[model samples]
Target: MVARERIITTVRPLDENRIRGSFINCSKGEARRLTLPRLTEIDWSEVDFLGWRDPKAAHNAYLVTPRGGEVIGVALRAAEKHRSAVKQSMCAFCGTIHAATDVTLFAARRAGAAGRLGNTVGTYACADLACGLYLRGKRRPAVHNPVDRAPLEQRIERTLDNLARFLDEVTTDNAR
Candidate 1:
């Protein structure tokens, strides 16, 4: 049996330009305040984007997504969850069902004054934004798979599309 290397490099890590320019509402100051994750902290072979919660700002989260050959970073405000835990939850971007504790509410800043005016877009996202990893099977869910499960490639594409759609939403509001 030939041992097939499962992961091909479909995604790349983001550079400073990609990270700074990724956000619609982030001020230059805010972007400057942003911290990049250390290479040691991530398994680059598995992730499509770089995402993490701020160590200094617990309610803050960040994501950088790649399109074509370029990347964009998004700033998000994570909403607090219930003290009580539940058995099942769903990740809005990846749409994978998970334990309630696995999903967290993430609010992205609106593109313009709507955001400064206190308007934000939110979703129940995987706590680490590791949906790509989950979809790619680099990571697995806490539960068993559905009998009617789709192909792995299809699931990865779907997750990527979902993220692109969310980025479009952020950009669309920026155009306003």
Candidate 2:
């Protein structure tokens, strides 16, 4: 019997120009000014999205993912106060369990006029913004859950769904 190879849907590798052009929630100047991760150091096939925290500015994080066949980026800010590590938190994007200190509440302004008017959306996510890596088993959390027996594909789909929903919340104008 032959073993079946797993099919993975990996995000395409992006150039700095494409990444800098993908932001939907921030000004062109802001996008240009944001620090970028080392693109050359990444293995694009192992990730479903490109996410990172700004090393120069601790509170700033960014996510760039493919949506509707186009790349879109969003700028996020971490909450000033962190929850206690005694409580375990599940990352809404990847379902990875983490000590509360490893997860954070990040807020992104809405796109267009809504954002200009101060509308924002937020979610609790892995503090390092490495949900794709966590879901793929490329990285491990401090505490492990042996009971989450879902197949990798299913978990990937769920994470993608959660991400899409959050992106919609950030880009959609609910006032309409």
Candidate 3:
């Protein structure tokens, strides 16, 4: 049997220009206005994607990741209401089981015509958008329950695969 390729779950450092240029759903002006995270302070080796909630606009969030050697960014809108702390929810990307309060529903407008038509896709993700850290053990979730008992490399691959599917949904022009 052919061996499956291992996925590298790290992103190269990104500058402001590159990050702004990577956005697909938002207009140039919107992208320009979007606040960026402090690039220099981030340890790129620890992250599979760069994600942050917009400081200037609390409900807005952004995710930038490398797909097939190309960097792509998505603008996400976080739901105003958060899940209750009493419940438990899992991150769709990293598979971490978090206190329900830690998971947020984020919607991304599809690229191109669909987005212009007001079409959006949503997913349940970590409120902080720090899936990479949780997956790599850099950060721990509030709850200690583990969902997937796979090896670290395999978990990384699963996370990236989940992200790829989400990206495809957002970038594909189903409106055509």
Provide the TM-score for each candidate, comma-separated: 0.79, 0.90, 0.91
Which sections of candidate 2 miss by over 4 Å?
1-9, 83-86
Identify the superior model by lDDT, candidate 1 or candidate 3.
Answer: 3
Expressed as tens digits, the lDDT of each residue in 110-172 for candidate 3 is: 999999999999999999999878987888989887556688878878888888888878887
- Tens-digit lDDT string for candidate 1 (29-89): 8988877677566776677667788888878889876664556677998888787646788
Which pairs in model 2 have colliding backbones? Answer: none
Show how many residue pairs clash in every candidate, following the order shown.
Answer: 1, 0, 0
TM-score of 3: 0.91
Best by lDDT: 3
lDDT of 1 at 79: 85
* Per-candidate local distance difference test: 0.71, 0.86, 0.87
Flag clash pairs in model 1. 22-73
